[model samples]
Structures are given as structure tokens and as C-alpha cells.
Target: MDDPIYDIELEDCPICRGAGLIQDEQGWSVSVACMDCGAETAHAEYRTPEERLEAARRVALLWNMGKVVHTGMSD
Candidate 1:
């Protein structure tokens, strides 16, 4: 099976310059997180798959804008 794609674009982590990942919580909500720094954007809730994709995009936008919350783990 192929990996599901969200078609979202994200920027590198502002804290650690690492990759960003789009994450979903049991199909309920979506957010973007840094792979190395653990910085994350605010969660966006969704219902359908379309909404989930949109939510993923929303978080990606936040991540690109450097609007994520640093978890302090990078420090």
C-alpha cells in the first residue's frame, strides 16, 4: 500500500532546522511537528478526509510561518 498523502507543504523547523511532519490524531485532528526539535503547531480539528487534508494544510501553513510552539525539548 502506498502511504497516504496530505498534499501539504511545510518549512524546516525554526528551532532545529529539521524536517516537518504532518500528524493526525486518530482521524480527529491534524498538526505539523518538527522531526528533530519537536516543535508543533496548534491542532486543527476535522471530520471528513477532505477536512483532514485541509487541516493538515492549515497546520503546514502555521509551521511555515514559524507559528509553532517549541516544546523546550530542543533546549
Candidate 2:
């Protein structure tokens, strides 16, 4: 079996606490905006791997739905 994704160490974002997305004067952006926060920096206290996977699955489902409705099926 593959290792757990969340098993990796998680560094807390001093600015957003690892929200993975932050809002500023320029609007929303990835966590990369924060100089103090680096990519792959997970939250010390955040969702588990299972939770993240579930969320991702839901998003993918929505994306597929939109694609089917607007673009139709691709070959």
C-alpha cells in the first residue's frame, strides 16, 4: 500500500494556517503567496488524508459534470 499523504510533516502557515488558499488585495491565490509558507506545507492541525481525498473527489465530480454539460463528451 502507498504511504499516507498526511503522514508528511506539516508546517503551519503563520499567515493563513494552511488554508491552501488565501485572500488579499489581489483576491484569492494559492498558499505560495506567503513568503513564510512554502508549497506542500501542510497544517499542523488540518484535515486527514482521507478527508482531503474525499474533497478532491467531490471537486472532480463537479468538474466532470460541468464538462459534460458545456463541452459534451470527448473522444
User: Using TM-score as the measure, which candidate wins?
Assistant: 1
Candidate 2: list runs displaced more than 4 Å. 1-46, 67-75
TM-score of each model, in listed order: 0.86, 0.29
Q: Which stretches of candidate 1 lie over 4 Å from their true place?
A: 1-5
Model 2 CA RMSD to the hidden true structure, in angstroms = 15.1
What TM-score does candidate 1 reach?
0.86
The per-model lDDT (C-alpha) reads 0.81, 0.30
Q: Which pairs clash (backbone N, Cα, C closer than 3 Å) in model 2?
A: none
Report clashes for each candidate as comma-separated counts: 0, 0
The 10-residue segment with the lowest total lDDT in model 2: 23-32
